[model samples]
Target: MSEDLEFDCGGNRGDGRLIYTVTQISYEIKLILEDSYPTVWILGEISNFKLYNSGHIYFNIKDKNTQIRVVIFQSASINLTFSPKDGMKVLICGRVSSYPKRGDYQVIVNRMERCGSGELYEAYGELKERLKAEGFFDESAKKPIPDIVNKIGIVTSQDGAALCDILKVIDSLNANIETLIYPVRVQGKEAEKEIPQAIEYFNSNHKDLDVLLVGRGGGSVEDLWAFNMESVARAIFASEIPVVSCIGHEVDFTIADFVADMRAPTPSAAAEMVLRSRNDIKKRIEFLRESLNGAINFILYDRSVELDKLILSRALTKPYLIYEDKISYLDELDNRLLKSIGSLFKSKSENLGNVSHRLDIVSPLSVLRRGFSICFDSNNEVIEDSKDVNVGDDISIRFASGSLNAKVKSCE
Candidate 1:
């Protein structure tokens, strides 16, 4: 073979030209793009926007003539103050680079700004006011959180730190409570859609849930944009289950916080609020037990004192003395009764004797006893007149104790 027809082992043909693999050429192109424009600023309208679950944002920035593909990685995107959406005019600062695999040029955005105003903040404010006017944030409409929750439905990213924090707090405090997690994207383009649907599902299917906690850990405004969405807010407002919003850190607030039944500063705080600590409940029960014991002891002591008083009372201790006094009084009455009866009998005897003496003085037999005689004619009637006795008539004379029969000789 000729020297020009032979391939050089050092990556060159017999010609003066160098040969490159597809990867080598792609890498060369990427290096050129990166070196040519290390950083640049562009003003354009956003289109074809998307936020992936990996926390990366992809979109196209277009002017009238042309458009360029842009990407914001998770690290840089986490620092963005607002979410980028289609049709929004934005000014972006980025480094130019190419995807070696696809051999495509793109801008890796590090910072972005709205062309006119803070679009996301303005939208947030406007929607908040409108929903407030519509009574979405009224305290009267908000459901009351139960003092004790049994089952809690959580709507958030399943693998996020927020979920872990909530579960850790709950487990530390109360383990008996059941947590039914309804996982969803907490932040992203699809997050707003998935969150509301999770809430509706819990409300429709798991009515047994005492409360629902919807939230995620601390993040940038763009990362937490899903919670600030109108759809998420409306879903929270419309939920039948009492919703406790735990989004971002203490200082970080979202539309969901206002629309929810309760707002917790953090995911751990939400767990603390929904369920009481096991130690706390045990302490309360112990307090009640002590109170009850105190009351019972007081009552028993009072009853014992009353029983002691009864045992020492005159009616109980000197019971026989009372009966003895009564007996003495009865004996006095009996003696008085006997004395009265004797006096009555003696007076009656004297009166009866006097009456006997008076009757004897007026008796006809008394006259006979005093040496006088009662004469009777033949008819045996007492002779009181001389005419009662006839001459030659038989007569009888009655003395004190004897009667004599004689002939009547004279009258009177």
Candidate 2:
């Protein structure tokens, strides 16, 4: 598509102007309108409101003089904070485009806001900020989702599609999961109060549930307003069981989403996320079984190899040969011991003989045998001086092997 388009006409008029076909003109006008007003904001009061089952809203927005058809496709409509009614004032931002099927000019709205709902949005911001500052959305505060989920508690309207969708998904996965549904009003008066009550109900009564799913199917912002309430958010934050916020569609977000332990875009997705499929579980078991078998086989093979080595070893094969070798070693040790004892004894005997020879060289008896003698006086003491000799004194003289009694005159 170009800013300027050119086309061929079969023939020219008398004025020499080109004629474009209806389809071509419609396309040309669409291009011109889109190009001229790619983006615009309009203020008007809503009228002729129509919300189709497809989730698209077709309505007219007009002041007193004229009205223009506004088309809010499902993609953009789900984000609407308020449902458009016959007399509600609104502001919309959109692009001007031609609808070729109807050959009509319409505005394809991308954003819509209620005329006086700014304060509500402001309050929402304030609460979000407050809760965030208080650590309501902290990741550390979130509980872990159990790896295996056997039971779950749901907080939604019992008759809503969200429950059915969740159950359908669980069934498709063939998970043996049980559900405890706490029915409550998802929207309308007191819906916010009911939502938190339902959450608390499950928490207090059914503490054994593996996880809690608190949400509903896709809806307008007003419909999901219950989830955005502070009470609902706090309840989710305080839940002992892990909470999975499965509110609306992927593009939609609520305060519950931030405070929850986990978030799922839709109820069916929550089911798929929280519970493993039977086939997947079986595959996991099979993988573990194979791994265990491999480990056991490796261990057995290793032990078997060790056992074979032991069986082939000589220590086990030739018992008598080992005993014979031991006997031979003992004989050798005995001979070595005998030689050691004899050598020790001979060394000791030679040392004793040397000591005896040294003693004999200094012995008195040896001196006597060498012709040396000792004398004794009357008290059997040896006299070395000549002055005290008396004729009648008695003394004993020791010779080599005998002693003789003598007079003191022999003192000299």
Candidate 3:
């Protein structure tokens, strides 16, 4: 039976020969692998990992002694619980299959696990520690919230419950203030990057905003991790506009809280802090108006009293009283003038009598009364000497009342 089954087709029976074709051998190996093993687990270090655009992951798993090729379908790769990196030790569970055309074998992975805490989480922690050391969470950089803000910019999910609470509070306080909402992701992996970017965009575009209100409703720390991200903190600190961080329940605090201008216990509280009730302002205005009216009335009463005093004085009520006071004084002045004129006339009469008596005492006619004769020339001039008479000139002799005319005879 052994002799009949001997089939050496490459050479004659007496000569030794070898027979083989690449395609035939490969086909036989594929059949053996398909028939023998369904799937198996492989533990090795990953190498030459590639993610194709078609969503397929291709890689090589290598050990110190051997290595194997791997291909994970797009669906399976997407469902992977952890991200894998080159040189990472992992456990891959899949089926071994042979490629007839390439004449090779590869493992098609359905599941995989990292040797430790995984690549994605490791990167996250590393970045977080680096940012924390750089003081991204420092409180000194925080800004103070304005007591009254009429324009507020909000960064949160559009459909989130936090937005509803904020709106309700704002409406109750002051609805006149404008609120601008910027919708963004609030959770998950994308949130870590997108939330910060959204805040930065608003800061760059809306510089006129009075304040930024960033928040969400209550959630676990992991759920709110986006707010604690370094990018979010840096964005808040660098913003030119003030920020109000209201990122969960009262007990919650994030990195954003430390970097923002102020912190609110909740989203509703943040809204209340930014706006004041209209009733309060109205009450204040009413109080001021009353005080002003009271002051004006007091001033008017004082001025009225001054006017009454001025009217009662002599200068205002009686026009002729001032002239009556001066009339009596005028009579006294006339009496003084008459007495002075009378005294002056009497003194002048006495002086005239004295002068007349002195004239009589010195008269030249007194000499004639004493028996002395008076003589006159023809011209009525007195001839005192006999030698003054000329021959044939007429002369007059007077003795008191009588006079004699005589011709000038021979005079010795």
Q: Backbone clashes per model, in order?
A: 0, 0, 1
Worst 10 residues of 3 by lDDT: 1-10
Candidate 1 at 224: error in angstroms?
1.6
Off by over 4 Å in 3: 1-140, 143-148, 277-290, 305-412
lDDT tens per residue, model 2, 41-153: 67788999999999999999998999999999999999887778998878787899998767999999988878674455567778989999999999899998888888999
Question: Which regions of candidate 1 deviate over 4 angstroms?
Answer: 1-116, 277-283, 319-412
TM-score of 2: 0.53
Superposing every Cα of model 1 onto the true structure, what RMSD results? 33.3
What would the TM-scores of all predictions be? 0.49, 0.53, 0.42
TM-score: which candidate is best? 2
lDDT of 1 by residue, 1-412 (tens): 3343343443547787687666667777899999998767677899999999999999999988999999999998898777788999887878899998798899998878676655776688799899999999998999998876778899888899999999898777745888899889888889989999999999899998999999999876688889989999999988999999999877567889989999998998988888864456768999999999999999999999999999999899999999999999999999999999999999999999999999999998988888999888788887888886678999888899999999977776
Estimate, for each residue in 1-412, the C-alpha lDDT of model 3 and write its tens digit: 2332243344444655555456655666887886775556566889999999998999999988898988999989997877787898887777788877798798888777675634544454466577668875566665655555768899888899989999998877646877899888888878877777777887788887889988888775568778867677778878878888988877566667766788887888888776653445656889989999999999999999999999997878896887887887788888888888998889998999999888877887777888988889999999988898888899999996788999987777
User: What TM-score would candidate 1 get against the native?
Assistant: 0.49
